[model samples]
Target chain A: DAGVTQSPTHLIKTRGQHVTLRCSPISGHKSVSWYQQVLGQGPQFIFQYYEKEERGRGNFPDRFSARQFPNYSSELNVNALLLGDSALYLCASSLAPGQGAYNYGYTFGSGTRLTVV
Target chain B: DQQVKQNSPSLSVQEGRISILNCDYTNSMFDYFLWYKKYPAEGPTFLISISSIKDKNEDGRFTVFLNKSAKHLSLHIVPSQPGDSAVYFCAEGGATNKLIFGTGTLLAVQP
Candidate 1:
């Protein structure tokens, strides 16, 4: 089966602009999560959706939001982007949520690289 | 404050040698710990994970050891190959289901 797939492999935006990143989870997966990775740093959690409900959220600002569709696809939106928002946005998918999926580990997409100038 | 940290920014090892990468986490509540490998321009790939209840977990050439008292974890790759060269990240998962990650450590395996 195909793994998690993210759209618009790359993007360039300006400060104050808005951008949307998309992700399609693996077939039969119902949980999707988003993370941001700055250069030289590991990925930081942003949001997690399970069964189309918001299960958890990270410390990101209100400018960041995400939602999962019935099909388990997800979209991450950033409003009023800042230069600090420039990073790779990753999407991960798993069979379940929370500790239930810990053993198998979440499968991640290649990520969308966003640049805000 | 960084809940998870990888103090070593990089590590270099000769092929066929063992490569060890360390990680420290401040949150004892974290129930699950995971290791991920990332190549340039790609998202992190799930490597192996260990439950807080377990002290060690191994798969193929990769082995992870957890020290609950020290709040430390290490990933060991035996007979390291050049393909193993990449940035490795340690992440902690808890009730929140979100992963708290450490600053990555770049491992370069020389042939």
Candidate 2:
């Protein structure tokens, strides 16, 4: 089975532009989470959705939002993007929220690199 | 303020030797601690995690130690291999179920 997959491996947007990144969760998985990783830093969780409802949210502003589709895929939308939004947007999937099976462990995809010009 | 922190920017260890990575957090509400290893240009992959209930947890060659009082944790890889080289991050989980991450430490295992 394939791991979590994210779309548009790279993206560029203007300071005031909006950006949307997509992710497909692993088969049979019901949870999808979004994270932003700045250069040289670890990932910070943005949002987590389970069963199409918001399960958790990070300390980000309203400019950052996300939704989970019926298929467990997710989209992360950032409005009025800022230069600091330049980072790798990662999508991680698990069997369920709160760390998943965590035995074989949680899986992460090659993230979408977003650069705000 | 950084709730989670990895003071060491990098670590170098010889192959077959032991590799140790450290992390610290300031939040008293953090109930879960985790270690994620990220390769350049790739997303972080969960390495190992330990709940606050236990001071120690182990999986194969990887072990995590948490000192709640000190707000510190450490990851140990025995007989470290060159393949283990990567940037390791420390994360803390709280009521929000969101992960707060540190700056990460680049670990290089010398052949």
Candidate 3:
């Protein structure tokens, strides 16, 4: 089966602009999560959606938001982007939440590299 | 307040030698710990994970050891290969199922 896939592969935006990143989970997966990875740092959690509900959210600013569709795909939106928003946005998918997904580990997409100048 | 930290920015090991990467976390609520490997332009790949209840978990050449008391975890790769050279991140998962990740450690295996 194909793994998680992210769109645009890369993007360039200006400060105060808005951008949307998309992700398609693996087949049969119902949980999707988003993360941001700054240069030289590990990926940080942003939002997690299970079965189209917001299950978890990270410490990101209000400018960041995400939603999952019935089909299990997800979209991450950033409003009024800042230069610090420049990072790789990664989307991960799992079979379920909590223990059901813990053992299997999450499959991540190549990520969308967003650059805000 | 970084909850997770990988103090070592990078590590270099000779091929066939063992490579050990360490991680430390401050959150006691974390119940699951995982390791991920990432290439230059790709997303992190799930490596292996261990429950807080277990001290060690192994798969193929990769083994993860957790010290709950010390709030530390380590990933060991035996007979490291050149392909193993990449940035490795350790993460902690809690009730929310969201993972808090470390700063990452780059491992360069030389042939």
TM-score of each: 0.97, 0.92, 0.96
Ranking by DockQ: 1, 3, 2
Chain B TM-score of every predicted model: 0.98, 0.96, 0.97
Name the better of 1 and 2 by DockQ: 1
Model 1, B1-111: lDDT tens digits are: 549999999999999999999999998888899999999988888899999999999999999999999999999999899999999999998887888999999999999
Clashing pairs in 1: none
Whole-model lDDT values for every prediction: 0.92, 0.87, 0.92
Candidate 3 Cα lDDT to native: 0.92
- In candidate 2, how many Å is residue B110 off? 1.3
- What is the full ranking by lDDT, best candidate first? 1, 3, 2
Which 10 successive residues of model 2 chain A have the least lDDT summed? A98-107
Which runs in model 1 stand beyond 4 Å of their true positions?
A: none
Model 1 residue A64 CA deviation in Å? 1.0
Across residues A1-117, which tens digit of lDDT does each residue of candidate 2 receive? 888999999998999999999999999999998998888777888899999999988789999999999999999999999999999999988888865533444578999999999
- What candidate 3 gets wrong by more than 4 Å, as runs, is none
**Stretches of model 2 off by over 4 angstroms after superposition:** A99-105
- Per-prediction DockQ comes to 0.84, 0.62, 0.82
Ten-residue segment with the worst summed lDDT in candidate 3 chain A?
A96-105
Could you tell which candidate, 1 or 3, scores higher by DockQ?
A: 1
Pairs that collide in candidate 3 are none
Q: Give the per-residue lDDT of model 3 (tens digit) for A1-117.
A: 789999999899999999999999999999999999999888888999999999988899999999999999999999999999999999998888664546777889999999999
Better of 2 and 3 by lDDT: 3
